[model samples]
Target chain A: MRGIILKDLYDNFCIPKNAAFYIFGALAISIGFFIPSEYYYVLISGVILPLFGCCALKSPTEQEESSSFNKLLITFPNSKAQIVTAKYLLGLGFVILFNFLALLWSMVQVYTHHTIRLTEALRIWGIGISISLLFLAVIYVGFFLLGKRNGTIFFITITCLIAVVWGASSALLGIQTILSCSPGLVICLIFSGAVMIVLSCLVSIGIYSRRYSTGTKNRY
Target chain B: MDYAIQVKNLTKTYKDFTLDNISFDLPCGTVMGLIGENGAGKSTFINALLNITSAQYDQVTILGHDLNTQIKLIKEDIAVIFSDSHYELSFTPLFVGKMLSKVYKNWNQKKYLDYLKRFGLPEKKRLKKFSIGMRVKLEFAAAFSHDPKLLILDEATTGLDPVVRNEILDITREYAKGKDRTVLMSSHIANDLDRIADYIACIHEGKLLFIRAYDELQNNYGIINCSRQFLDTLSPDDIAAYRKEAYNYRVLVSNRQKLKSVFTDVWIENASIEDIILFYTKGEKIR
Candidate 1:
């Protein structure tokens, strides 16, 4: 667990592209927030981060490093579960950090009259991160379930399906009216988001194990 | 004592190619050079040992641990270095120092710095911009910094200029400072392996032709040049493989002395690993 965090933070994120990712994320999120749009920032960050993140995972150039690093990680004196946990935890850590930063920036917007109140901001973050995690979940499932090639395509397809569903559902049932009067909406959304994140994460774990077992047979 | 690596009935079937029943062993503290063409399954073999992709685990074990259940333990003692640079090549070397230090339990900062100085790599320069030789040097430094007992290298020494290749070879030799250390390397540059590898395993078209001590392979294997009339006098069983080219006959033999018993027209020449591989895989011209 310690090993994965150290590698992800130090080896992966301390360089040029990493800074670019955070900087671009901040810029993209800021643009969405200041635009006075309906779920624009939330939607953009939700769709873009996961979409690009999956692309990053399957990047051909990244394979040179990933395969080697993964080789090192598997060989370490730890369980695959531990390695998986560490990687997910690191992903979790980064996502949480991004959430905090996103919240802080949103708070600044609220202070300046560009965004919603504190409670609304909290709800937005909760929903936003859940959507992003769903994207991540799809990415994980793709990598571990179908191998990198099929996985990227599957992830994109799933993301597109979600977008289509969201658009169609929103057309039929407006989001603002549902949330305007009911306090229960906030609690239900939180519970739903939490359940989705946990379920997606767990499904990814199952995919990862099955993938490893299959890989073990054909590789040797 | 059992060999460090033990593979029994190991097989992998790809759609187009099959790595069929591959098996070999390296005694502890010895270096084995895996020689093969580009698609000869060298990387596949290394990947299998590391348990990277889904590969057979029940039949292969290293360092006395079950490959399936004990891969992590094997990996802790074993280090792998591929030709590609794994560290952030765009950061200062110091960043590499910090990044790798935390992951490896026995990470030695002083040792890393010493290797940097020894390899003549700049500490402040970003690695992505370094010369290929320097990048390779940095990779070796990091792999060695961790106190690993086995080093599995997949063409890690390929493409470097000769002098740097020699330097890398020397550094690999130093990593074996302790008698218990071992290295398994796959290289196209036979000269490099010829200098350092104690054992040689030649793989071609997903099959292992042979794995033997470097000295024995070099000493026992030879290319016997003979004429058509002479070839007619010799039997196929007397030679490993004989080719009838336009002007002459090139015969590969396991024992050079066998040439004397053949027709007097036979001319036996000492064969290098390259010669053995070329003749074995492509059927080199005897003339």
Candidate 2:
């Protein structure tokens, strides 16, 4: 499992070829710096952070499919459970990293300009982490179940649907009202996201194992 | 005798094709060459053996371990190489070595580095920058470094130049020098197998045509070239398969010595592995 994770990291993140992705991440961070403090959490946590997290989770699966590395992976000494768990662990690690960065940036904003309180920033961070976890769960399940091309389409469609619904709800209930109720809502989201993530991991392991047994090209 | 790989009643079916009930055993300390034409299920067979593809099998035992219950343990002692390199293109050989070192318990870092150096592979150069031949050499280096008990190659030398292919064959031969080591290489390139194989298992249209000793094939099998009238005189029991030409009949006979002694005037030539495969695939059944 450590070897598979290391291989994925080497393929997707720790390589010079993916320097462009790092630049994109830096650009997302820089873009967040200029947004109004009141809307900072909205833009960074709601949009930019989830988008970045999704890309982080998606790239390794895409590379594995394009290169047929998954076929090679099954030949390794690792079990199917180990292979599926490694990807989930990586996704969880990225979600934590993204949340940490968001908190750090939020601290900078709070100290530099006293617009948002630290406690409020923490709440926003919690919500952001929850949303990212849910998003990761959905996309990971899609990639493992539907494969690369269909999975990408499914993810994009789901993202668009969520955006449309979120926009409609925000317009109807108002942004300030949503923020006021978010403390309790954030807890619910976190609990639901954690459950979804666990379910997604188990489902993915079953899907992957079935693919090998049935000789289906589910991911590869 | 101990077998490195044993399969019984193995079958995998698809919408268009099926690898029908096939069974064979690759004895320890020997190279078994699997030969078949394109789309003939050589890869499917290997995949089934490695549990890469789910297939129905009554029994499959590799290195004395049951394949279904103990594949993970079996995988640790085996190395497989396909025609294409499965390593990440962005990774340098140095990084690959580091990554795989954590996967296989028996991975030898010094031996891996030695192989990379010996193969003239650049440690820091990414695999995408290397040629196909170079990438295959890298895979060989990795396969050998782990000291696997069994090495399985699926058309691993197909696209290489003759020189590099010969070099790989030499390395494979050396790897099998260990008394416990075995190799099961599947290739349409009959010449490579002819040089190194101890047994030849021929598959034609998803069926096992024959699995005979290489020595028995060389010494006993013969292609008889004779007129139609002369062919008619030979017993059907002696002719395994035969193809007819414009003016004569070419028959594949398994008992060359017996046939030669019975018909001293008939022209009987030694059957190469390629000839045997061609006769089996293209020749009509004796019946």
Candidate 3:
């Protein structure tokens, strides 16, 4: 499992000779977060970070399908169940890592700038993590169940849907309406999000287990 | 005989194809070569053995463990390599080795590094930069480093140069030397199988045509060139397959010694593995 996590991290994230560029980009984003006037722009980075990590989760499956690396995985000392578990766990780890950073960044921006209160920052972080988890579920379902061609289409469609919802809500519902929701509603949202994530994981596991047992090829 | 792999009534079906009731046993400490043409279910058979497909066999035991119930346990002692590299190309050897070291309980880091060095593989370079031949060698190095009890190679040397192919074959031979290790390799290249396989199992159109010792195949199978009139004198039972060419007949006989005694005037030559496969698969049986 450690092997798979390391392999996925390197395979999906490591780009050659571009370390300085990424470092520079990160530094620029960090600086932007500190500037009171650029808080809105820095929020874009917060959303982008988790999505970027989500994209990394997609690569391992895509590479496996294209390269027949599923064969290699079957020969490993671990069972197929373990392999599936590892992928889901790695994805969960990435989501937590990225969202934690986003939460920290959002808190810092809220503290530095008086435009958004602590409750508003908490609302944004809540929505961000929830959306990220839902999107992660969609991505895995797309790759595992729908397969490559359809999976790509599914991923793109869901992403567009998320974008449209966010855009429409910001324009019509307004940030005040979104942030000023009742605490009870927020608790309900948290419970539903948790249920969705758990259900998605169970569904993903079922799909993977079925595929390994009966599938002729790595459809993912 | 203590068997390394045994299958009984193994069957897998698709709407268009079915690997129907295939059965074969490979004794321990020997190489078994699986030969078949394209779409002949060689890959399907291997996949079934590895439990890659959901196809259920009546019975399958590998290295004394049930393939259905104990596949996870069995997998630890077995190593498999395909014709092409299946690893992510962006990963460097060091990273991959590190990952595998944690994955396999018996992974030997020093032995793995030694193999990489021996194969002239750059430790820091990504696999995408390596040639296809180098990629294959890297897989071989990884397979060997773990010291598996069984090696399942599916066309592992297909596209390789002769020298590299020979080197790979030599490594396979060395791996199996006095270690109670077994190898099951599938190939279209008869020459490769002929060099190392103790037993040859031929598949044609998803069916097991024959499974016999390499020595028995070489010693007993014969190709006889005779006239059509003379071919009629031989019994249909003796002729496995025959082809008519103008006035002469090329017949593949099951018993070389019996055919020789029966037709002393005719020329009977030894049948190569390729000839046997071609005749069995492509030639028509005598009516």
Which number leads on TM-score? 2
Q: After best superposition, candidate 2 residue B165: deviation in angstroms?
A: 1.5
Model 3, B1-287: lDDT tens digits are: 39999888888888989988888788999999999887888888988888877675678889999886788778888999986437777777887789889888899999999999999999999888998888888898888877888899988888889998998888888887856899999998999998899999999999999999999999999999888887788889989899878877899998999878876777789999999999999898876
lDDT against true structure, model 3: 0.79
Of 2 and 3, which scores higher on lDDT? 2
Backbone clashes for every candidate come to: 11, 0, 1
The better-scoring model by lDDT among 1 and 3 is: 3
lDDT of 2 at A158: 81
Chain B TM-score in each of the candidates: 0.91, 0.98, 0.96
Query: Model 1 over residues A83-106: C-alpha lDDT tens digits?
Result: 666656666665666666666655
Tell me the whole-model lDDT of each prediction, alpha carbons only: 0.68, 0.84, 0.79
Flag regions of model 2 displaced more than 4 Å: A15-17, A34-36, A157-172, A214-220
What is candidate 1's CAPRI-style docking category based on DockQ? Answer: acceptable
Model 2 lDDT tens row, B60-87: 8899998888888988999999875378
For candidate 1, the TM-score is 0.79
Model 1 alpha-carbon miss at residue A43, Å: 9.0
Model 1 Cα lDDT, one tens digit per residue, B37-111: 898988777776766655543477788877876776776677777774355445567766876676677889999
Off by over 4 Å in 1: A10-13, A17-21, A24-84, A98-183, A205-220, B228-238, B257-267, B283-287
Which candidate's lDDT is highest? 2
Ranking by DockQ: 3, 2, 1
